[model samples]
Target: MSSGAMSQKMTCDKSQDRHEEKVQSSCKQSPPGHMTDLGKEEVADNGRPEKKCVEEVQSLWTTEASGSVKLRIDELCPQEPITVHQMFINCVQKYGHLPALASKRKEKWEKITFSEYYRCCRMAAKSFLKLGLERFHSVAILGFNSEEWFFSAVGAVFAGGLSTGIYTTNSPEACHHVAKDSRANIIVIENQKQLDKILLIKDNLPHLKAIVQYSGSLKKKLPNLYSWEEFMRLGLDIPDKTLDDIISSQKANQCCVLIYTSGTTGAPKGVMLSHDNITWTARHASRAGDMQPAEIKQETIVSYLPLSHIAAQIYDLWTGIQWGELVYFAQPDALKGTLVNTLREATPSSHMGVPRVWEKMMEKIKLEVSRCAYLKKKLVTWAMSVSLEANLKYSKDEEKPFLFNLANSLVLEKLRAELGFSGCQKFFSGAAPIGSDTFEFFLGLNIHLYEAYGMSESSGPHFMSGPYTYRMESCGKVVPGCRCKIANVDADGSGEVCLWGRDVFMGYLNMKDKTVEAFDEEGWLCSGDLGKTDEDGFLYITGRIKELIITAGGENVPPVPIEDAVKRELPFISNAMLIGDKRKFLSMLLTIKCVINVETMEPTDDLSPEAVKFCQQLGSQATKVSDITGGKDKLLNQAIQDGIARVNSKATSNAQRIQKWIVLGKDFSVSGGELGPTMKLRRAAVLKMYHNEVETFYRELKK
Candidate 1:
């Protein structure tokens, strides 16, 4: 068929049929002259839309009339539309002998090739089918980043079911909400701990058919429960043709994965992502990041972040497959400190870290340096100063200093090698805004931490910073082929960031009203983040619209800038939360930097090495949080007041200045319900948790 003929046919299908109307109502129609960049005429043989498959997938999403899903395959995608199965097969065929996944088992790394990885996924898929996984049903995976987690997710998609990952930190009720919401047919868990959570709510999940534990021994055997080995063997007798037929029927436009939001405000909403959303975004995003193809050199990456998050899933699973990158799974206790160990061994080419991860790394490095010998400390400090000056000059397009190379060779390179970053080409930070302190710290070591900005609704990356396009405090340019515009711009040109591309998700699962609110009439995904773009198209996020603090005086203040300023002024501060929404004046809640119990992952009263040094420099003998808070050390108190006064001096207006502040006994943490799984602050939860403290701030002010 000719291009005109295909357009006419699609238009007729949209206008003449009721079902087509329903699909078109929810899906954005291709504008005239919108053509693929393949440089060849699209024909029916070139992966034309399959009506039945498209409708089947569209049925899973809920979208109001105002909302739109991008389903125009020919125009939106540069290459031919392809399913996940096809993408996986192409990767295996090209790099079958290459190492695809590596996992440490009993202190030895076990490697799996692409061919073996494909075989394992098929085995898992057949097992899922044998276990009675119905089409469109979900395979809910609750686990860490492991081979088992990868198998469960890919197998579910291969078996014609949606793969949904539940955060391991979720409580039983939270797990139940996701499982029931997805109508999960099978639950794949890491061990007995996750299984116990499911068992508590198994009776409530009507669609649940089986439970598979991938690690650890089961405490008690149940009829529906099976071990990983046992489950893989269940479908051995199942014919390959059975799974093949399911794969053949799958369409690129169909939903294959469900990523639930962190739900800072309320219950989590399931974000439906199509196969094209995964495959296309993976390919294009990799291109945007300047990732080399497997044909040239296969990149290596460490997978430690939660797979449930879109960023990790895209980078580790989809993008890894696209480029045949070797992915090494970190230990289950990766966040507790084992991550650097894995990074050292893996020597990955690319790595991604959340802000907290980078911050922790910065804190660790500083603490270690503080304990170094006097000469060594001074030498390292001098090298860092040289590197920092050079990098700052480079950022300003000025020539580097003459001693930069010497400093990098003598100290900076050694520091990076110690942190397992010697082989790292690109370092990325996302999921939360990284502080300027952390950014500058890494930059001082000649490490450029690229910042990316996006949401699950945009299939991970909308704006990405790269080596050539990087700018300080900017999220770089929009990903190749993606479109972004600031909506409802204010006087300062900051507004809600809107995105448009194939990367935009289908819609929310079973939430039409919410889905409608997600997109504007022009079919752009309305990112609730407030940001502005520079002349060079680098995006800078200011604050979240929902997180903006509106005072009683009707002044809207972005809390992040103020909070970050406070932390920058007071290096000992761990977290600073600006609170003045609908209140008389702005007040802040702060947490001092302290040691954390690795086992419990909880904050301890004992001050961190850096914090202790800060106190000593201020002529205070404080060693623990109690030493300062209880004893009310005049030096420490005065130091804090002076820091806040400095921050207040820079405020644009009096309304934005924090009037009162108090340090909390404990720091915020994910387990404590003050932060989400990604370490992003849950503002509503924090407010509710500290209601009394906030009330006291205002109450005492009146007194």
Candidate 2:
């Protein structure tokens, strides 16, 4: 079948009354002369299609259980499903000589070809098999992004086991939960620190059979613990056919990966993704993002984001493998401050950053610009205005001003090169809401940081912004072959964004109640995200259903928009969290930008360069957060009040306006439990942590 025909068949046409029936029928039918069950078609040695019994193909999607426990596989299309192993093999066959993974060792960089990567993965798989890894079991990797991490993850799947990633920052108890819940047969750690975490909880993990340390020497040798060298050698004696048979037994519909959500509100739930989910989403999403295949032009990407998150896993690992992109392993301190250094060297063709990452870059650039000579600063200011105007016009499909070229050549191009984004074709921000201030800041630099929206349950991205489909604040259109609907829409057309696609995960692992809650009767995954579609089908996320604050007057207010507005109005503010649930009026908790301790990622009292400059402009000598919070800096206090008033003046209703706010002494940090690993605001956690302060806002009102 042609690709277009397959896409049309797969896409759910919500306008038609028989759309649900069509979806059901598609899942039940077996097209003649086409592969039905196993993901992609099998080819014979003679280059013809290998035939399989229809009965065998039909059994792929079936399971012994009924009700919610049964895997949900709907909207089947004519395109055959492919396994992760098959995808890797296909890429190797086509780009075997191409660089697949690169790592810096000492002062030199080493590259591995696709063929070598596949071979190493097979070795890891054999090692897993030898270590007693069983079918449906998991190999949990706790470490930074590295070549070994990829090999272990892909190898586990090749050995008929699930690949799970434990966040490097997880505490011992949290790590124990993931390890025990997943029934991990083997735990792979990067260094002694992660090894120590596993050791502290190893007694609780009955299913854990082996532990492998991939980096650094073992602190103390113990039973069932092996070094990287020792682990790889254990599988050397295993027969290739032994591992091949296990790989062949794998099916496209079976769960192969377990992604645990970052528990912002509650305990993390393991998200189950099948072979088909990863394979299908990778192919379609790459196309949606206009990712060039290796056959066209091999792409390069620097992988630094937490691989535990679905966003990073899909973009850096699965998608990279799918397109034969060269994946460079960023240093362990990448998030601390070295990511830009890696970017400078790799000169990646594409980059993905969480909102916090982009925000930090913006602050860094702004600080440097603030210190520039008067004439240079003026030139940069003028160039930014020109580029911002041109880009805004371009987004609307309007002609760019003639001076755009001049500005790009003089200032914008150098800025991009300085930041090592000269070759970056696409810049993506996801995993959290990006403030419009940060979005516009990038636009001013001639960089279009497209926003993507999805959760672990949706594989990665259901809606994505690309060059042709982007809007100023919208998260772009639904990916091809996906279906979306806004449920329980309000008068403004905003509602819970429900999604259905090949990318939707099977179900939450061992949580039947949550799995059932995730989907409705029609098998659509309830995204739990409140959003609306524009006339052009672009999705604008208003807020999360869980995060929406209902005032005492019953007025609904989304805090993100309000908080973003306040931050935009006050350039010195680093974080603004709106609080007013069940209260008569709204208030806010604000934090000023301060110097961060790179070693510990803790906030310091010393003001950041930008903050210091802002205070200087206000004719204040305050340098520490304590200096401003002491109530002695009248200029700073008045400036903040003025900014908040300006933000309040634009409020649609009195209930939506912030009545009062307090500037917190310290900024929110992951270690402080005010933010998640992705740097997303933990509203519930924050409120609880500052319960005393929060009550003070309504103390007088209650009396």
- For each candidate in turn, the TM-score is 0.91, 0.91
Which ten residues in a row are the worst by lDDT in model 2? 59-68
Against the true structure, candidate 2 reaches a TM-score of: 0.91
Give the per-residue lDDT digits (tens) of candidate 2, residues 337-384.
898899999999999999999999999899889889999999999999
| Collision pairs in model 2 | 39-80, 39-81, 39-82, 40-81
- Give lDDT tens digits, candidate 1, residues 535-649: 8899999999999999999999999999999999999999899999999799998899999999889899999889999998988899988877732888998898899999999
The true-versus-predicted C-alpha distance at residue 678 of model 1, in Å, is 0.5
Error of 1 at 695 (Å): 0.9
